[model samples]
Target: MSLSLLTPLGHSNVAELIARRTLTAVFQPIVNFDGGTILGYEGLIRGPAGSALEAPGALFAQAAREGLSVALEHAAARTCVAAFASLGCEGKLFLNFSAEALVALGETRDRTVAWLNEHGLGVDRVVLELTEQCQIADVARFVTAVGALRESGIQFALDDYGTANASMNLWVRLQPDVVKIDRFFIDDIANDPLKFEAVRAMQHFAGASGARLVAEGIENAADLIVVRDMGIALGQGFFIGRPDARASREFAQGAREALDAGHIAVFPGATRTPVAASPSGGMAAAKMIVAAPAVPKSATNNDVLELFNRLPNLHAVAVVEHERPLALINRRSFMDRYALPYHRELFGKRPCMLFANASPVIIEKSMTVEQMAKLLASDDQRYLADGFVITDEERYVGLGTGESLVRAVTEVRIEAARYANPLTFLPGNIPISSHIARLVEHRAEFYACYVDLNHFKPFNDRYGYWQGDEVLKFAAAVLADVCDPTRDFLGHVGGDDFLVLFQSDDWLERAMRALRAVDTGALRFYADEDRAAGGIHGEDRRGNPAFFSFVTMAIGCVRVSPDTRGGLPYGSEEIASVAALAKHRAKQEASGFFVIDLDEGAAQLHLHEAPGAAMPQRASALS
Candidate 1:
């Protein structure tokens, strides 16, 4: 409700309300995902009924204008505590307070403790949520007050984090025990990659700071499941339990069932192609749909012919029954059959099913164009000529042609390839980062291999870039050949740098095989004399003659195990840095292969020789 819609009630109304202490408190349950149980209740305040200030927005606005915000909060706190104690609600009671009000609460600490004792509530059960409504002008004073309050067994929570005033600086200064993520980032997080990443970053920060995270405004089961699987501590929204006069003791049946489900929700992966104009993955089948007329299954061939005649550009007409598509009749084929000798009179009046293809391809409007591309290779070529029926929940909506599907699929590929290395046609940095994120979300053990060419610049100067390009392609091909198609991903991080996320158990063997291939094949790119001499003379950076050897491969591997995560969330950027650091060490080794046991909290380095398993060479150089 808009505060502007309320009448201008002077300080008299606010003073009267505070004197009567008539504010009502409603409690919303916050669920802890670990046990699928309520962790606490956030007490929300309401104004008097049938009045202009009944809505909280209007009530707060009036209080702020009348300069009675602190007084009003004190009254609201008392009402909430009294109601919560009387209703016998379990867990902590979270009371919202602005910075100014919190300072006042600290000053009245003894009186507040006495009142809580009288109401059968303990000071330890109260968590004060610092709201963003008021600003903190005195950092030192506010911090001191917050510290004093916590000394009395009170907990502080940074509310609406990511919005005004609830920033990282404040969080650090206050060292809040809890941080409630703003609803803006929580809503639709299952489908929005940006929001998902934002929340993930916040989760990482919380982990490092020893602060628990509560995702707010999770209004659907998909979002709830996503928040739960992402390892967020607590969840709160209308779907969990709406704010009511009587606090809920348990979850509703649907929410309980969802929380108890065994499987994790499949979060929508980040689209390979980032299209600014379209946020719906830019490949929905609906985008390529052609609004065409449909004919009932009982309609005669004559009726189909009439539609074709009236709309000469029509390619095919869908045969539907009760709005469900059953078949499609091609325009050209029907016309040709009608043109045959006496065929028009014989079959034109018969059911359109006589000329219809009963096994027409049906696609849902929500299917991605990439999914529809598979039909092009299917054995049935009928879709090419007769087109396909588009539906929403099995009901006919429109039709799509093979031409449009092909075009959309081609566009998606072209856009996606925009991020690929032009020379090697391998995925570039964006996709590499995306894949790392996916692996982290899966919470499974995997190996990250960072591949780079040793001394490539000197080779490029002597052999020219044409040969350099060939060498890069050769490296790509070697990596691709050894990768398990279903378990591994290969990406080129520009120039001679590449990243391989290996899920295969024989990742060590595969890395060794690639190294051997490079050791043997890389020499071919050099001239016969250079190959014989095992080196080439090139100008050094100081204009001095230097001997540059042929380019060799360096492989750095990091074992990312969930068990060793230490309950600390790892972002893709941080993981990539670890892999890169390992690669830097690999470049220092004689064998050009270094393995880091990140899972053991020890960056142990291992070196492997061809045709043998990895053997420990030395301790990790990393600190």
Candidate 2:
């Protein structure tokens, strides 16, 4: 069992050493950002004593060329599983498996399961890390095999996400439990704005997909801090712990200590963490209730003019009956609809009198400015109201003017822009959560659509960064235009992604058409050379030839209905959950658009059958 004999003598010797159980396993601990707890360790395999296969990378490479990669992989898996069992580590164990080797795993499935069960490890605790570098020729079979193992508690992960062209597609198709972001992106996230924005967007996408993001190749405290701030749940790098079998126990203890000490920074990249203002510390509470000012339905144009003169801050006058808001009269409406000479005569019969057609923005007493901003941004100009009448149920509580909403929304947008994906200028999780809460309080019917650009990165890679920016801006404009002021809302959730809302189901179809129209027109910006080639040029990691395909979008829609059972309205969190589920379903379908109705009390998923329905249409010649 000398190491020299096992040293790459030939494929036979390597296999013999593996069969003899001479291979050793090393464990590298993956740690949490803030807690610094050992989340898991990636089990790295080493060669037998004195072997030329001393370098793990070279060892695996040589095995692949020699056609013994599968056997070697199995041996490594068994060794790692055994070592994990002996160490009594509760965290997950990540074991690398080449796609080429996974195909053959079917033959050894039973054996592998038995061995894992024989040890303390179960399928759930062991994560199979599939490298994207290898081509997966048969995805269906691969998925079936992995899915079966997953049912037995085994989970799969895509290693080196964003490093390969096929990785993004594989991630969507395979839907792994974890995605290990490549080191190239994480290495300088804190210092490089471009890389930071890209990774942040990736993190948002991962969260939406219900997958965990692990930052790999973290070598310094700075890198660890940056990754943590970016909201990466799991991290593996030399700073946390290097790979070693006997060191696992020590590493776990150290990780726990670090967490307790708060030695790790949560978000190194955040300029500032948000702090809520103390309610009692802000504006003084009114000692007495002031009667809300009112405007009579019979008020003349002269009366309207007098009211504006009396109250300079007068945003709108409410017409009420028995404490119910009947209509809202704005200063501009009266001035535009009535003449000074007819003021008295028009008093009782003016067309500008508060009517059902007059748009009104309603708000609850507890609403924050951030929530109101999202509502304002979702609509077109016609639906713009001066302010919302704050109410509790049917009774008026107070007033929320556009000035107040403007100030509130500005703060929120600034905060959002800090962490938002810069390239796309979309709000991240922080704002989305607030917007959902506000929507729920309103008891409004709104549709939440999870928008994803299909084959975007490939397009980005083919086109330069400038072209990629154009595509993202184009999508943003499309979303803004498609959203109807009377019934819809839209927000940029992050890169190549958007969250759109509509009060009417029919509006979803309309919005889709508009999105398709805009996307089609936007594609023309690509130079003729790139269009003729059907791809753009870029440099690969190794500075090799890189060509990427065109971009398209996939949408997942979910509708949130008003809850009438309780006197209070439904909340945004519920709607967001439903929307996320629908998006997942849409991604699963061949079509790009999928809709789900959560109001049905169960998941009812529907997919739009039109191919490229989300794609923009060709423009007609005019002028």
Candidate 3:
């Protein structure tokens, strides 16, 4: 009934409304795509019931006409702060600030500060959103004012960016902590290349500015997916949420989970790949540690015993102290003691800490499965009996079983070795194909660099197979040295051919670095006279001596974007065909350099070499 008074045409005096503080607040959640968590809520203002100025836009416009813009804005701010306090939000609050109000505050934000303090909200909890809708005449003064707020522990975000204030100049001058990409840029972004490019550029710009990017007005699941693929951390809009007065924390369906998983291969007619969680001995511990919330150390022995009995399938329950795992209580061990005479009467009421294994195997989520296994190797009995605790930054996140770790690490390591090249030991055909398929399923970005050693066979004919093997090993080491084990994949496609799957943002850098390292390392393999002469005499296919420059490396780089696929969406044969074409173009260069195929339409045609590469050396390293 009260909401009925907030009609767009409800007549009210703007000045009188400001004086009476007749306004209300609504909240919209700002979700974190990477973490699958509610990052914060953005508080929007509404006018009082039954006022012509009830609509927030109308209210602000009326106040500006009445020369009370600053007063009305402050009134709205106070109302939102009070409203947020009543609900007890768990995250930060993003509030929209008009240019007029900020200019009027000058260098003093006493009003906003006092309201924040009065509401028990920290300066860190407040983020003032400066939208481009309010043009700034003196950009410098605005920057200084925003800087002052930042110095006081308040954060600033450039709202409605990529529209009127899309200028690089504005971004440089304001240097906000976040850029909320205007909704138009995000609308239908999944199908629009221009919008995708714009957001992609902004992503790089955000990285350079040390600011995060938020995609606002994500109205659909498909658009939200594209926004996430472009690597925006914070997301908003009707799809993620709508403005609501009740401060509800719910978000749009499938958006949060899909974003956090960082992959969506919902291509029609595509079968789901085997997505295994070899979390142990892998990346963060949170990946593998199943969430069985820990029991406090102070929990009575009876509590632990009852938990064990209640959950018949339970293997163990960790005794945690302030989020840290202090001990473990195994079902079998506890039952054995409970079966003894008066065991319950003797220790049922005592703290579980006393009966718990004070030194139960504890493992952090950050530790690689390799690291956990190495640590577990110290105690064979414990490895078989008690599992490990997975902690994030020293706080328990979940539990890790030794059996799970062993199974995951052993399978991955053995599979890797089985398919590895006999000499280089880099992954071979099976692992390489599986890796690409898996990454395709997850919709990850990777650069597939197919490297072919030019003149390698000829060099072997002249220098013997053993010498050729030496050069191959040398090249492999150089490639391995450039790979970031944590984020990238390196494989040997047998002989003088190698494949690198780059998953990091700096993939181009790492790829270029590898190519450069190989070029330099190849030179060392040649004898002094050959290195200086820049050519070696080798027998060609015609059995005639040919002048071959020191072994050169040629790389064909294929960009596998999240939304990338050509004629054959999930076909391994198509990948090889495209790779062969890229390598053919790469080998055309006079000197060894890598070239990238940017066209998504024709994978077989129009492979373009990446710019900024060094001058091509004139030698058929493959000849």
**Model 2 off-target regions past 4 Å?**
1-11, 252-623
Q: Weakest 10 consecutive residues, lDDT, candidate 2?
A: 275-284
Model 2 residue 562 CA deviation in Å: 38
Clashes of 2: 9
Root mean square deviation (Cα) for candidate 2: 30.0
TM-score, predicted candidate 3 vs. hidden true structure: 0.44
Per-residue error for 433 in candidate 3, Å, reads 12
lDDT digits (tens) for residues 304-335 of candidate 3: 88788788877788888788888888778888
Best by lDDT: 1
Worst 10 residues of 3 by lDDT: 268-277
Candidate lDDT (C-alpha), each: 0.79, 0.62, 0.70
- TM-scores of the candidates in the order shown: 0.47, 0.42, 0.44
In terms of TM-score, the best-performing candidate is 1
- Sorting all predicted structures by lDDT, with the top scorer first, yields 1, 3, 2
Residue-level lDDT tens digits of model 2 in 437-545 = 6556545556678776765766676566788888888887677676543235455655566777665447767667855765477568678887798766665667777
